[model samples]
Target chain A: MASNDLLKGMLKPIILKLLLENGKMYGYEITQLVKEISGGEIELTFGALYPILHKLEVEGIVKTESEVINNRNRIYYSITQKGNSKAKEKIAEFEEMVKTLKVFFKPNFGLKYEFIG
Target chain B: MNSLDSKHIRLIEADVENARITINNLSQELVDHICCEVENLMSSGKSFEEAYTIIKEQAGIKVLQQIQENTLYLIDKKYKTMKSTMKITGNVSLALIAIGTALKIFHYPGASIALLLGFVTLCFVFFPAAIYLNYTYKKDQKKPMLNLSILIGGIAFMIGVLFKLMHWPGASLLLFVGWSIILGIFLPILLFFKLKEAETGKERSIYVLGVIGLITFEVSTMFKVFHWPGAGPLMILGGVLLIAVFLPLFASMKFKKGTFTMPQFIFLITTSMYAVVLTFLLAMNVSDVVMDRFVRDEANSTKIANYFKNKKTVAANDSTIKVSTELAERTDNIAKLIFDTKIYLITNVEGVSESVAMKYVSDPDLINNKSNYDIINHLLEGENNAGLINSLKKELNEFKDKAISVSTDPALTKSIQELLNTSDKQMGIGGATWEELNFRNTMIISAMAQLSEIEKNVRLVATIVK
Candidate 1:
């Protein structure tokens, strides 16, 4: 659950990146894609996902349309041009942050030191 | 399997029912999500009971409840934002009221409509919006102070409306009392609680003192309206109370906080000043108008005496020397008394112009004093050793001629003619003395000249007295 907090920060960029590539997705479809990508380890609640989707819609970063699928009305959301640009920038920043952190995790090649009194 | 399907259907119905209760208690969005998950599971080859249980476990009851609360919180946040906008609108309306009030006071032609609109906004719009906001936020329960404000605002509105419609004396005092209660007592108290609740009590004591000042103002106004003594002292005491209690409290608060808002200082200073100014003006204006009426009456009597002196011959009756003498002496004494009283009043009272004082003395129709014709007739008949009937007659003719010269000015002429005509009618022919007949005839001529003046000037006099 605590690890999910770190993942949650990247979820919008990930979803936005996916939508920019795929064009549009429904709520259930987005959840499935996220689960498949994480090998079913990460689960996103519809309650959490819907609000962000609605907020993005309200902020003009996303647009939605409803269509009848299998006798149910499924709402599909697509990233706007603004959302695509934001996703691109966020992904670049994420990659930069990962590269920066990679240096700290590497072993240092310094001479061994004896314990001092 | 058929039995299983029936059992599943029953469970599904029960789940839907339970979800309805949850929706009522929690957020509809969460229930809808749970319902969707249950439906999805049922479609994926699970029995209804199994699907319901599975979905219920997937979203832990506690997490579901928390999510529900969060959703409600979000909705409430949106509602609060909308309400705040409405409140801003209400405040704008209140500001418009103040602007309208200012325009009205400056003598704008449409000031009456503005005043009406201002009162309407205060009563119907701003006050009710405050109440509605308090209710919507559920602040009415958590903050009893808000309720107090609403109550005070409603009462003040009612009293304000009543004050406007009625011409009751001391209405302004009522208005002042109402203002003090709302702005001073209720608002300050509410603000105090708000500050205290926010843990910002540095200026709480100062606000409390402001409230005390307001209460004192209210009490003083009450005293003034009821005509109770010590009203002045009470008002002074109230002013002192504000300075003594509020000023020190304000200083201490400022020392502690190192800052205060501009509005806080403005409200404090303006309220104190308003209290003092209003109380003083009310006391002065109301008392002065009442006192002035008495002085005006006295001056009017003296003027009536002078008019009588100018037209004495026209009023003289020659029924007998003894009767005429007594009447002339009585009229003379009354005239002297009126004139002396007017002089004394003018000397004593401030704002009583000598001309205005003299106007009261010079008013020709003061029924208590003898008319101008009476004085003239007295002199003509040689009453009280006032000799020379011919001289009195000439003087009467001269005054008549002067009156006639202006009589061409329609208003003056019409007024004079009306006076003469009324007097002539009153002086009938039967049992009248020769002097009375001549006086009535002269008055008739004077009236004709005055009517000619009115016709020339194109003015009308509805009533005239000689």
Candidate 2:
């Protein structure tokens, strides 16, 4: 599970990337998805989440829609065109960073043979 | 299962609610993350109470405190920004006031509009903004600055109303009274609070001095309105108080804080300049009125002279023959002199000539003058010429009677009578011509010249005549 600090920094990009892939999600649904993806090891906080959503709304990167579902009202957010493009760029950058980190952890061929025996 | 242990569930609910409200200051996403973590823990083997407490502990008190502190910091930052904006607005308002005052002094067409805009900016926009900013600053501290601003604004409005009521030239008294009222009324009030908050004796003394000075000035102005003998000196003293005492005190106050505002400078400049200009104009207008009265008297004398000359020529010739070349030439010369004198009089008078002329002619000595030649010479001699024309008419009538009695030649007697009658008729026509041609021309030319001078001085069209 990612630490709260790590998650705080990555939250916006992760949310953007998720919205870009899944198209739209409500507040409760987004929290549920993050928990499920992290195998119940990670969580999102409502206090931190709503302000970001509001800020994104103000910045025109995200837009909200309200609908009545199963007798309860919910607000859903979707990535704008600009947000979508930014999401793709950030995901690519994150992937590249992960790829570079893999090289340091990979074992040498000789050391691997000795350890295996 | 003992109804799912309602007490335990209730305790968990209370904790969750407390966390939600307090954590709301943090980002919505963080709260959502904490909520999801607690929900997941509850879904696992842990009870709801255990899950909530565990997640809350893991989140740590330091993170929540940081979030709270960050929110407070942002609020403070926003407040500071608003304060700067208010200060800037106040400066702009004062600038507009200065520009409006300049425009009005120069008599620009849109000066009234400029003044109205300036007042609106000061009273409605900038002052309120300043008060709001001060309110925000003292939200958790002292409360004097906001109250002071409001008091100053009210005093300013009253001064504005007085300005309109008095309609005094140059707006000097208005500005002085306005500034004084603000300083006098608000200084003590602000000082009272300031002393309570800061316990500074220096600030209190400065405020006390300001109030004393302003009250003295205000009382003096009221005395002036009552036409008291000591009013002028009192006004001067008040002006000195403002410049020497209050202004320096305000400056020192600003220096202590290492901050200076443009409004303070503007108020100083505006008040002093208004004093100088108003004093100058008042002195100028009074002298002009006195000088104009003297010039108009001279013009009336010239008019009387011209009147007598026309009468003399008419009484002499009647209708028999055109006034002899000698008399015509003499009359023309007198007429010309009278014409020149009238022009000189009108030029000197500038404005209020007609009233002055009317006042001049009302004297019996001037009104009795009827003969053109006698009146001209009498005016030239600087003596009474009022009855000259009437005397000349009587003299000419007596001469006609003597000619009728002594002449043996009937034809000669008849021709002389005819000449006398023609002269009288021609005199009427000639006098009318002189008035229309010479006097009217002098008036028109002098009026235009005076208008040009006013335009040059005030940058405005003189609406005095036209």
Candidate 3:
């Protein structure tokens, strides 16, 4: 689990990852899925989801379709072909970050103390 | 799960519209999201009202506006910079214009410089940046013509104000056209869009009233600019409609709905203050004191010239008589040439016939556009600088040499040379010839007064020769 503050810069990749897993998703569905995946450790706000989705659509990484369902308009976002490579790249970058950060969690505490002394 | 009736959907729609979401399609997305949230909550045994209350707390106006801001910020790379530039330039130009107007009202120096800089920056930088930012914020709204009209009309109005303050020509044309566009093009289109999006009859009435008031106010402003009759009644009527009728209604409606924001309040106050300032600027009149002074100076020089003209030369010897006669002829030639030049300047500046110019030359206040230097530039400094004024300058200098050669007193010769010298005078700046110094940008009355002064000098030297 990670602090929600850590989710700020990584929201795009998380959203892309979710879009890759599910071929298409609405804004509320993505929020619910992120909360479920992180086991409530990361809570996406009720208002913060659409900007990233809209930006992804603007960058041509995703596309949107608006449909009338149950007497209301619902927008669904789906990843484009361009988003596939971007998703893989972002996942690899996240993996690299996790791998580099793992060193701090390893048993190197006593080694650093000995080297400083 | 509870499904919403059409009535409930309309409630959601009104709530979204109440947010006044400016971004394209944002209200739709937010309304749909809230509907889904409410339906989900209702399935958990909550009533429709309870679910909707919870949803309303989450999707407030501030939150919706924040989402729109974030989306625009993410999509536009230059948004932050453009916004900052618009703010800085708007404030800077406003300050400059305020200071310039204060200085001009007090007749202090540097007012023109400040006004010029303020207008240039406002028209060129601040206006374009503001319009660009506004257009980008609502890029998908399909109202490009609204922005386009505002850009053109706003720029034209600003430049017209500047030119009017500077006493430049074509100000009336620009002011008229700018206001016409705003009245005819901008207001009509804005009213159409507002009417289309209006939810209540009250809102539609307010929008219509506002447009009618603006049209009346703009037309009255044009009438005031041209000083046409009935401008006063029209101005008062328009002001009453806007200040007394439209503004309070609009404010109360917004405040009652809790949609009034801090920026809107600030904008209203500033706009009222701006309109008052504009009214004062329109009422301002150019001072005639400088023109009166030139007229007085010309009259004094004329009196001195007549005294010199009537003075009889007392010649004790025959040689002295010949020298004095020749000197008088030369002085009269120079003086007549100066008078002809004045007549020529008047005819060319006013684009009138020679006879009318000759009649009007003695009273130069009758000539409009007194500061137009195009005729002077053409006659005195033409493309090659060897204009007709060069010949006049040469003849005057020759007169100076002739008087000097005839005089035996060294002091007298020295005074004559100094009095009639027409060589290039380096005033404050550099490299302007004598003709450029005198005639360039000089008012016609002042130019005529200047010729009068020159004629007096030539006469003074002639008396010395006698």
Top candidate by DockQ = 3
Residues B13-85, candidate 1, lDDT per residue (tens digit)? 3433332223222233344355566667777788766877787666644455455444444445655565565
Query: Against the hidden true structure, what lDDT does model 3 obtain?
Result: 0.76
TM-score of each: 0.35, 0.32, 0.59
Per-prediction DockQ scores?
0.04, 0.04, 0.55
Error of 1 at B231 (Å): 3.2
- The CA lDDT of each predicted structure is 0.51, 0.50, 0.76
Instruction: For residues A35-111, write the lDDT of model 1, one tens digit per residue.
Output: 78878776766656665665566667888776644333457789777776776777788778878778756655232
Per candidate, native contacts kept equal 0.04, 0.02, 0.72
Instruction: Give lDDT tens digits, candidate 3, residues B1-466.
Output: 6777878989889867776677655777888888888889999999889999887777777788788888877877798788778889999998999898777655467888988998898999999998887776654258888999989998888898888766577887888888888888999999999899777999999999988988888787788666575665677677778878988898888888767776887799689758955663443321232445557567655545544443333333677667767879988787778878877877666556788788777655356555445556775555676765776788888877776666666555555655676778766767777887766765666667777777877777677534
Q: Write the per-residue lDDT of candidate 2 for residues A24-107, one digit (tens) a residue.
A: 887767767877887877777654556566566656787777664432234678988776676677778877876886875686
- Report the candidate with higher lDDT, 1 versus 2: 1
lDDT of 1: 0.51
Task: Judge the docking of candidate 3 as incorrect, acceptable, medium or high.
Answer: medium
Q: Which candidate is the best by TM-score?
A: 3
| TM score of chain A per candidate | 0.77, 0.75, 0.84
- Model 1 sits at an interface RMSD, in angstroms, of 6.5
lDDT-based ranking: 3, 1, 2
Worst 10 residues of 1 chain B by lDDT: B457-466
